[model samples]
Every structure is written in C-alpha cells, then in structure tokens.
Target: MADRRLAIEAWESLFRAQHEVFEVLSNDFVGTDLSQAEYDVLLTVTRSPAMTARLRDVTANMLISQPSVSRLVDRMVGRGLVTKCNDPDDGRGALVTATDLGVRAFRAIGAAHGKRIAEQMSRLDDDELLALRALTEKLRAGVDVDEA
Candidate 1:
C-alpha cells in the first residue's frame, strides 16, 4: 500500500484546499437573489432536459440532505423560481422545472460565478487543471452514485 502518512497528508491537503476554494467561490452569492444552495438547485435543474430535473437528481447533486432539498425546493417554488410536479414515470417522484425568472437568475449568477471560479483557479495552468480533473475523476470512480 501507499505510505499511510502520505495518504493522510494528501487527503488533508485536498480537503482543506476544497474548503478554502469553496469559501472563496461562495462569495459570488452575496447580494444576489439566490443563496448558494438555491443556486446549486438551479445549477442542476437548468442543466437537465427541458430545464427540468428529477427531485432525486437534484438531491443527488446537492451537498445537503434530501429533506432539506425538498424544503429548499418548496421555497423556490413559493418564490416563483421553479415549479414542482409529480414525475409522470414514477408516482412517488417529483420533477422540478425552472421558471423564466429562475433561468434568468441562474444565468446571471452563473456568469459571475463562472468568472470568479476561473479567476480563483487561474493559479493552476491548463495542464495542471487537466491533471487535477483527471485525479478527481479517478478518486470519484469508486463512488457509487445512484440515479434513482
């Protein structure tokens, strides 16, 4: 096996770096209509077909718990950012669709957030970024992500 100390050190450094970079990127939500969680919701929803995504899928993409996601989606629904309805294919599942307002908000925040992310990641050159992506994908390869 790899050296235990080196493994721990590598894990710690990766965790801390992710935390710090996320903290910096989260500032893009300040003074905006969407909270980071809401933005995350829109991030998943807007990328799906017809600007709609399954509720389970949203929960999957989110860092928060399933109940919390349900509540957040409710709030978004109340705010007219998204509409929720039963998933036709699955009786127990819900489908979320972004409203025109939601799309606008997501696009506005995404443009700024994308720029900020690029600026923060500029510390790494193209080759390093590609390597980082490959490393992360490899790390995630063992994780079992559920689509249902």
Candidate 2:
C-alpha cells in the first residue's frame, strides 16, 4: 500500500512538472509563425528521412488525436508549410513533406526554441538531466509496450 501510494505521488509530481514546463515553453511560440501544435508536427516531419514522414507516423508522435492531427495537417497544407501526397509505397497512406517554406520556418523557430528549452532545462545539473532523461525514457518504454 505504501509502495502504491509512493508511485502515485511520483506520477503526480511528474505530470505537474511536465505541465509546468509545457506552459513555460508554450510562451516561446506566441508571436511565431507556428503554434505549439504546428511546431510539433513540423518537428516530427523535419526529423524524418528526407524531411518527409507518413501521416500515421506524425499522428503517432503527436499527443493529439488522429482526427485532430489530420485537421491540423490540412491547415498546414493550406498555409503552404507542408505538402501531402499519396504515398507511393502505400496506396492507403499519405506522406507529408516539408516544403522549402516549411523548412525555413521550422529552422527559424527551432533555433530559438532549442535555446529556450536548454535555458529552461538549465535548472537541472548535467547529472540530474541525464538521470531524468533515462528515467523518462524508461517510463515511455513501459507505456509504449501497451500502446503497441
């Protein structure tokens, strides 16, 4: 019982910390060309091979619902930040590729955002940051099994 209670408390702390950090980081996007959601999508898209990713891959990386991601992608397409095309390898799947405009925008925002993230995280010492990263990855791996 004590163990379970401790686990619950730890989880709550983790959740609150994530929320707080998210709120702080979200401020960085206020006047930018991308919303947090759009930046998230672009981040994943940009990280993928050749700066293109499958729609399902993007949805998987995002915290938003599949429908929400679809809608967001449509909005981004309309803005000319990304282009969607039928995946040649998978007839049922769509591929999202960052346009030159999207790449430029992402690069501009990413530089500042990266610095902001580093600054925010600087509160943690290097050792603590390494431990936190390992712990979070472990937690994610546990959850990912269920997700898969």
Candidate 3:
C-alpha cells in the first residue's frame, strides 16, 4: 500500500511539473499564436517524409476527430502554411502537405521548444534521466495504445 501511494505521488508530481513547464512555454509562444492543436499537426506534417500527409493520416496520427482535423487544416491552408491536394493513391482522399512557410515556422518553434526542454532536462543527472526514460518506456509498453 505504501509503495502504491509513493508511485501515485510520483506520477502526480511528474504531471504537475510537466503542466507548469508547458504553461511557461505556451506563454513564450503567445505572439506566434499557435494553439497546441495546430502545433501538433505542424509537427506531424513536418516530421513525416516529404512533409506530406493525408487528412486521414493526420486524424490517425494526432488521435483527433476527422472534423477537428479538417477545421485545423483548413485554417492552416488559409494561412499559406499548408496545402491540400488530391491524394494520388485515393482519388477521394485529400492530402495535406506543409509549405515552405510551415517548415520555417516549425523550425523556429522546434528550436526554442527543444532548447527549453533540454535545459530543463539538464537539471537531472544522466543516470537519473536514463532511469526515468527506462521506467517511462516500460510503463508505455505495458499500455495497449490503439492505432487508427
């Protein structure tokens, strides 16, 4: 019982720390005006090979609803950050691809975010950080994440 209590406390502490950090980062990114959802889509599209993805792919990758993804994509397209094309593989499917502007934005945001996260992680010793990674990976592996 004590062990379980300790574990739960550790988890809550981790979540609280993460939330605080994200809040700071989000504030720093306010003028850029990228919502968390838009950033997630940008990350997904930018990381994918050729910076291209189908609408369905975004829904699957982001674990978001199709309509939500569509609305986000539509906004992104209007901003000239992304473009929608007819999917070659599926005539009826719409393919989304990041534009040069999108890549530039992603690069800038990713650099700042990476630097902050790296600096925060540097507070931990190498061994402690590695142990945390191992434990988290083990916990994640135990979960049954549904793929769409």
Candidate 4:
C-alpha cells in the first residue's frame, strides 16, 4: 500500500486541481444562454444517441440531486431546449431529448468551452494529458458506470 500521507496528499492535489480548473473554465459560461450545470446536462444529452438520453443517465453524470435535475430539465423544457417523455423501456423513468435549439446552443457553447478546456489543459503535454486521463480512469474503474 502507498504511504497514507502520500495518498492523502495526492488526493488533495487532484481535488484542488479539479476545483481550480473548474473555477477557471466556468468563465466560459458567462453571457451564455446556458449555465455550467445546464451545459453539463446538454453535454451528456448531446453525446448520447439521437441527441437523447435517459434522465437517470443525466442524473448520474450530474453532481446535483435527482429532483434538482428534474427541475432543471423542466426549465429547459420551458425554454424549448429539450423535451421530456416517459421512457418506453422504463415506465418509471423519463427520457430527455435535445431540441434543435438545444443542440444549436450546446454546440455553440461547446466549441468555445472545448477550446478553453484544451487551453487550460495545455499546461500538460499530450503524453501527460493521456497519463492524467489514464490515472483518473483507473481511479474510477472501481465503480461501475453504465454506457448509454
């Protein structure tokens, strides 16, 4: 086992780095039609097949509570960004589909947000970035994540 002290220090470093980068990258959302949280939801939705995703899948990717996610989806529905309907596969679950406007906005924000992320991550070379991703993935590998 690694030294407990070193383990704690490494965890702290990873946490702080993620928080700091999140703070810095959040500036990319300013003056945008979508907030950071909304962008996250759309990110998951847009990446899914047919620009649609299960609400639970979105909820899984979000840090917020399920109820909060539902509320956000409702707001997005009001904005004509997405539509919600009962999942055919799961009667108790719902599916969220991105509207054309939602896809447009997501793509618009995504282009710049992606560039900003790349710029922030540029501090590390490609190899370092790959290693970082590997380490993170390894860390998360203990948990089971569903691919949808």
Best by lDDT: 1
TM-score of each: 0.94, 0.93, 0.76, 0.93
Off by over 4 Å in 2: 144-148
Clash pairs detected, candidate 3: none
Give the poorly placed runs of model 3, Cα more than 4 Å off. Answer: 60-66, 90-94, 146-148
lDDT of each: 0.96, 0.93, 0.82, 0.95
lDDT of 2 by residue, 16-130 (tens): 9989989999998989898999999999999999999999999999998889999999999999999999999999989999999999989988988999899989999999999
Compared with the true structure, model 4 gives a TM-score of 0.93
| Candidate 4 colliding pairs, count | 0
Lowest summed lDDT window (length 10), candidate 4: 139-148
Error of 3 at 110 (Å): 2.3
Candidate order (TM-score)? 1, 4, 2, 3
**What root-mean-square deviation over C-alphas does model 2 reach?**
1.9
Task: Put down candidate 3 lDDT per residue, 1-148, tens digits, no spaces.
Answer: 4499899999899889878877876764677746667777888888788999778878776757889899989999999889998898999899889999888887777888778777778879999999989988887687775752
Tens digits of per-residue lDDT, candidate 4, 1-148, equal 8899999999999999999999999999999999999999999999999999999999989999899999999999999999999999999999999999999999999999999999999999999999999999998885665542
Better of 1 and 4 by lDDT: 1
lDDT of 1 by residue, 1-148 (tens): 8899999999999999999999999899999999999999999999999999999999989998899999999999999999999999999999999999999999999988999999999999999999999999998885776742
Error of 1 at 66 (Å): 0.9
Ranking by lDDT: 1, 4, 2, 3
